[model samples]
Target: MNITHRVSLLCAALPLLSGCALVVNAAPASTATAAPVFEQWRETQHRGGDDLMTAGLGLEGLRASVAPVFSSPALPTADEARRRAIWSSWRGIADLTPGGGFGDRYGSVQSAPGREFSAYARIPGARHPHRVLVQIPDNFDPARRCLVATASSGSRGIYGAIPVAGSWGLAHGCAVAFTDKGAGSDYYDLDAKSGFQADGTPATHGALAFVPEAGTAAHGVAFKHAHSGDNPEADWGRHLVQAVQFGLQALDRAYPQSAPFTSANTRTLGVGVSNGGGAVLRAAEIEGDWFDAMVAGEPNVSIAGAPPLYDFVTQAALLMPCALLAIDDLPQPPVQAQARPLWTQQCAALKANGLVQGDDTDAQAQSARQQLANAGLSDGALRAGAFSTGFDLWRAIAVTYASAYGGFAAGQHPCAYTFSAVGADGKPGAATPEARASWWSEASGIPPGSGVVLVDGNAAHVADDPLRGLRCLHALGTGDSAEAKRVRAGIAKAAANKPRAGLPIVVIHGIDDGLVPSSMTSDRYVPQARAAGAQIAYWRVTNAQHFDSLLAFPDYRKRYVPLLPYMFAAMDQVWAHLEDPTRGLPQDALIETTPRADAPLQPAQLSIPVVSSR
Candidate 1:
């Protein structure tokens, strides 16, 4: 039997409502199913220098600032890139510091040797391929078959979920499947005219992971998410389902004794964070009986006509700096940026632009605060968002999403915001070949980091002032232009449909998650999910914000509980309920928690409760 055959081809939408309970197994895989998108795969083995979880970095090594070095920067072996990519991803998602739970408590820190298989999968009729990687842990037992399919958070590369879903699956001896969902840091350097291949080496010709159409690129870098010419976000869920199929097939290859691995013989789960979480939810809605359960943490879900992310992010980009100052005791204020006078500039700019009317900076801040609140953001979220705002993420996200939602080509970016390597002066320049070579390992999918910068072409005279570009992005969300219509149309396609009944779902989110704020996501979607009769369990943890790695900072540790531990805990709860109905899922309630402050996190601070679901 061919495992790819039963990959859950578009199920007939029964007139029933949203997501269901434990999914009953499907029929065995066969060739007579629908046509396949990922029937072929490339395989590799990771044992000594790198293993399944953390790439053999272990708890302490993962916390290290430095990653395994490439023997030659311009020509990294695929193995070298894989190891470093895992290292970067772990640091990106989890809080590996001594104070945060690296190994002592909740994290999946042990090394697990494995075989990996990858398929450059294309959605039907789509020209670009989303990269999918599936790891079959050496300890995977066909008799106790399980698979966890995850999508990468944000626009990060395939390894983006390494520390989140990857760790959990490998630790549980499950085949872990991951996809970049058509957006990754496997960048195409337009200047170099070469793009990184699946093997992590650059190629000027042939099928690269992402190569901007010839004569259709700006003089900088072009990443898949922003310039793929296809609105990939619309198909994030389909990519993940394909990833699950890829895993089942790879498992069959790894252990032929179990000739055809199917969902009937496996306990498959979908788990993701941020955008990954959104993808998991989308899959639950679209694919019937494909997954036994799902665990989503801080999903950046898009529901057209219901407070779109681009609108909020673009608005936050312009208003958050000034407005957050109105909130008292926000952690990590933009104090250092005072040298560039950013916060003051935002306040002054807002007042001058008629966006806010105030007699003083404080009054201007108050008006901006009121504007954001009126727009649907919670004060708690604004406080947490200030941290990311300080890091200048609001502008980066606004710039990236504007291109993605509009399907804007590399050269035709909204507001002429281009991505490229920049100098200390914040001026864009052709990236050095050496820098381009290491981008796959060093940079997150989004720019404004790892040598790549988001440069506003119009900000030549006033690099400190970002009003023009931001205003353009904001208008794309709220205005009525033809280009703006394109963005809105793309956004409409991203709105999630109801999940098929009987696939148990658990959504866990931090009340203070500013990156993908709950007020804009789970808070809005969960109620709708329940109203639609989806058997979903929602847990909103207090005192926890989005990013766990930020907890490494002393001030952050004192203010917020790490959301990862709770996410892992929720995964356990959902699994337990699936294994035995009597175990019951977690109650749909807010779980209280406390920050560790200066001390090590105690079990009591977590306040995780377990009881029969009511």
Candidate 2:
């Protein structure tokens, strides 16, 4: 069968083999009826009520259940004065200095029988302080050098690093370290009269701040200081790199005689997922000599690489409004009136412009084929499928856009433009007149009838037609303000993916990823990296979503839980290839894996036939 046909068949069987029910059931429970069986199982696990011992295995299950009851004794702590001196010794080091040379900066160090040494280091930066944790094996010896992996934490914060990759590094006899780059604590102190205010208050501590209103200077000030600011050099990515470097320094200082740690080797790797993944890739590109290999799963690398198509601010403006309307359970009449027309108009525009049409038409099928072809998925026999249909595209835009909006408007990082009419019961409700007026008046400057529409008050909200918003934002070009220009430049610099020559990098992404589209990697990063002469391997998993691995929901957990091992295995291969030139890394491969209830998950890999990119 041709590649197109193969892809179609894979797509058809995805729901069954890859657990489509999980995605279908991903939405919040609408009715009061108990959640699906899998969801219930997940809840049980969360509450510590599930009997793991009997659920999947026999003796092993019992051991798993009882294992946590036995607690290990705590290790001794290091002297506070000595720890301070150790860190003070390296106070003026440049942020990008590479390798392990300053481990003594760790404030606390304790060693267990098998776990060896676990230490925490606090590295202060201009914007915020970085907290890094390092783990060393009990058998660590100065004469025998070991691999060191600097892991980046995902969106949930620094605690997520060890579970994602650090534990695996430790098990493989590699020292593992991670830094919390102030994700949880980093914020602008709104009440601090000036940027230099020492109130120590976090940016997220109070009411949501305005983004960039013209007349409101307070809003602009908050926007400038918020975590996502106009300064690229001071952003989170820059801080992460510095933290990683500091963590490495602490490792070397702690083990000063350990082979005089110098260069990247099979023993030095960088690993992360999502935001963390992006950090890893950015660090590799900026500090090329620090790591021999890197593994980035669903890295957020397209903000700059893909240009107008994937910039975060543009995406928020274009997609979030429409998404908010679609998911609101009890939207007001005005909201529905505004949103429905916007959706219909955009769909009509798409059809009229030949961007989408009925799936049966030859022209439409060819168009669909061409688009997929760009992502290296065209097969002669494969016809334009559901995605090409105007109706399908409409539905997709609503669902995916809504999801994106929900994430963007989440309480953790609310923007001034993001407004939600959520009811006391935690469900979306109609907007009050006052709420509607607040946002509408502020947005009055938006061109009238230009896709951006205000629909309600008090609980009011804004809805932007997706396609129109995209075009409008693209035209805006990050606004005319100096700060806006800085923000744009910072994004471009941070998102650049120019890896140094000969570095082994493996990027793995799920084809169905909703948040950061998989094409960002398969179609953009891979080709760009190849063009740069970097030794890179790309793995495209059949059915996976952005939060699949991190969420405890049954379907998501099941589909992605088993894939971690394969990802690590791929990293190992990439590292090996860096060490041995003759060894080859797999490229354009399809990895299939099943989550096991009885044992550890394993993946079976297959080589995908090469196809020309459009």
Compute each candidate's TM-score over C-alphas: 0.92, 0.51
lDDT against the true structure, each candidate: 0.80, 0.38
lDDT of predicted model 2:
0.38
The true-versus-predicted C-alpha distance at residue 593 of model 1, in Å, is: 1.0
- lDDT by residue for model 2 (501-612), tens: 8777888876655455665444587778789898888887654555432223332333333234435567666656655657777566776544333233323222222322
lDDT of 1 by residue, 95-140 (tens): 8887676566786778999888876767765557788889888898
Model 1: which ten-residue window has the lowest total lDDT? 12-21
How big is the positional error of residue 196 in model 1, measured in Å on the Cα after superposition?
A: 0.7
